[model samples]
Target: MSVFPSPPSSPPSDRRRYAIVGLGSRRELYQDGIEKVHHRWSALVAVCDSNPGRIELARRRSTQNGAPVPLGYLAADFARMLRECRPEVVIVTTSDASHHGYLVQAMEAGCDVITEKPMTTGAAPCRQILDTCRRTGRRCRVAFNYRYSPPRSQVKDLLMSGEIGDVLSVDFHWLLNTHHGADYFRRWHSHKRNSGGLLVHKSTHHFDLVNWWLGAVPVSVAATGKREFYTPAMARRMGLSGPHERCLTCPEKNRCGFHLDLAASPDLKSLYLDHEAHDGYWRDRCVFRADIDIEDTLNALVTYNTGATLSYSLNAFNAWEGYTVAFNGTKGRIEHSVVESNYVNGREAVQGGVAPGGVKIRVVPLRSAGFDVEPWSAEGDHGGGDRLMLEDIFLPEPAPDKYLRAADERAGACSVLVGIAANRSLESGARVQVADLVGDLPVPAYAPAGARGESVPMPERAR
Candidate 1:
């Protein structure tokens, strides 16, 4: 492992300095973008994380054989990265609960920030981050790469083209197969306190799609959720009399279908299995642990300011991983279904993208015969969204986007509030108002329901 750089030291030659916090599985998306894809224009100045082992692992993975290793810091010295390494932008890929702190402090320390989605865990932290952005005048960009996915971008284009007329309602159901879905239960994400459950952690991407597809802000959300699968009882029912704390030591390792061999994948092996001593963060905890607090199934009804609504559901343990979304509009209905290959995150190069030949889009015009609409196809990682987002963030000569895929703090807050409200509704068994959670937020400039690009405000709720 590379030694931590001394304070007040200069970073690699003349290039934009970026410091990344959190060396978990998701860190590769941004780290590789800076080091491999856009290394010339951007320099990875420093990496900080609570886990020394993960930090060392990231250092090895991100640095080329002959390249000067980027600096490393313990999480406590994050401020040192700002003052000493002097990063122009801070990239936060930390645990869900810690994002707001890093985001707010980085901005206050005179740096722009880029963060993974959901922005913050809940409404309190969301409001703080928003207020910090307003006070510091620093940009906080949330990575919502789904908007840039080719087939999804095409869906947005079709909706904006107005052939579907004004959107009135949306039906979206996302499924996560056992392979990918069970992994969530193994990590910090299994608890609501750490990840805000899947509603905030996983569904942020889905809810953002709905908000952007309709070009509206969510006003009210009523939801119901439960953990029907991934239970200790289910494991016993399957005849696994003995289940270990994790897959690595389980007595039923060979017999259990959900067992994850951390040693099999070089990436997962180096990144997680070899580093368990640093933080005791097991990479393969049993999916049916009784301590798991988040729901495995969720259903929500969301109303938007544009009078558009969403009927959304998420099933964590399913036969396959993907989503089917249908938009109902004044003119017609647009439906899209995608099947995605599911793998344990960080265990493989392709995390979650469109499975080969897994995309289908259909259009049904009102008072007209419905026909299949062939849309633009995608190739590459993350359905070609990650590459585009990387270029938009790092490259100086990227194409201007009409879909407005780049998301700001406002958009990030708007998306997570839906899930946050859903979590609340799940507990109270009543509809929860989004505005009641975070006060009113400015509506994002989303592409209009028609081809016209106009900014529309979600209707003001009577407080």
Candidate 2:
């Protein structure tokens, strides 16, 4: 890895100095947030990555953003970067399993941290993060942009307002169509050690949303997972001879539907294809490779501390993308669904972009007609949640949010532990308690919701 010299000294401004680790595509959100959107209050001081090419690319991006080029460092020199850059905050966008190390070290070094979701892959790292936060007395924020999506936040508001009464149970199903879902099997996420499967890496967004919406803690989970869709058998069924090492060198690329021509997209080529020699990390691995360990289909039954149960399923091979969720409450039911446009990561397309007229919401009161709700709308990626969340993160003092959308380590653990327990359950063929996975995981702070046993008007003798 090529290391750049120390950044030149300059007169300090009131803007918060920031350093970022891991220069993958996900880091661009925060990078642009600091340089372009919130430049008045935030500044990027340093960028680090395992691959030198990405580090150079990040610096070039800084120049392109009309910001001063930050110093660049290899992963081994992270501590050096922190010491030299003296950033007030460290933003971590590393691979899922590598998040905990950077988070812990950044906090111990007296810098606040903002990490991309899933926090860490497994229970042990989760415990380490919680313990490190407690011991160091530093802030660790998990960027859960899903919570900031207007329609989703509207759901939170309705629940807190007792629109659906105290929720008795929940049914949520998330679908990932071939385009976006298959991308997971193409990258490092294909291995459980790297991503903890979609159950954690992808569903962390969904799980955190549920935990936040209901104001509850997950207590136990029973789950089953399998990889039936993206496998050698499926590859054969599709008339391919068998899975090849990767799409770049595959002999059957012309016949395979899953082929990803990284060189075709300028963004993918610059971000991953051109940087291959540095790490030997293939950006277009075969989805049906036999070495893939993670599951493509998953189901889990979760029980919450609030006495509510959740029946959730995630399927990677679906006709459409997005999710349908319903909250079954004592007085009524709230049904919410969204259809997202399918797009692979690192491409020019919006990640998790909502389809036109994609959002739907309905509330059915007991013994009464159900009415449709005009879904709240926003104007950016991930249903505009990304822009709103960036404002929350980079702004010095964001407006006080009633939804309590800002999440710390507690909320992070709550979301990750569910997936962790589910993984354990998948192995043991039995229920796994969240507490058993990690103790002292306090319930996350949530906006007030309808409490159980609260007085409820009797439904007018259901006709």
Best by TM-score: 2
Candidate 2 per-residue lDDT, tens place, 122-216, comes to 99999999999999999999999999999999999999899879898999999999999999999999988999989999989999999999998
Which runs in model 2 stand beyond 4 Å of their true positions?
Answer: 6-11, 447-451
User: Each model's TM-score, in the order given?
Assistant: 0.94, 0.98
lDDT of each: 0.86, 0.92
Q: For model 2, where is the 10-residue window of minimal lDDT? A: 2-11
- TM-score attained by model 1: 0.94
Give the per-residue lDDT of model 1 (tens digit) for 247-283. Answer: 8889889889998988887888988889888889888
Q: In angstroms, how far off is 244's CA in candidate 1?
A: 3.0
Cα RMSD, model 1: 5.0
* lDDT leader: 2
Q: Native-vs-model 1 lDDT?
A: 0.86
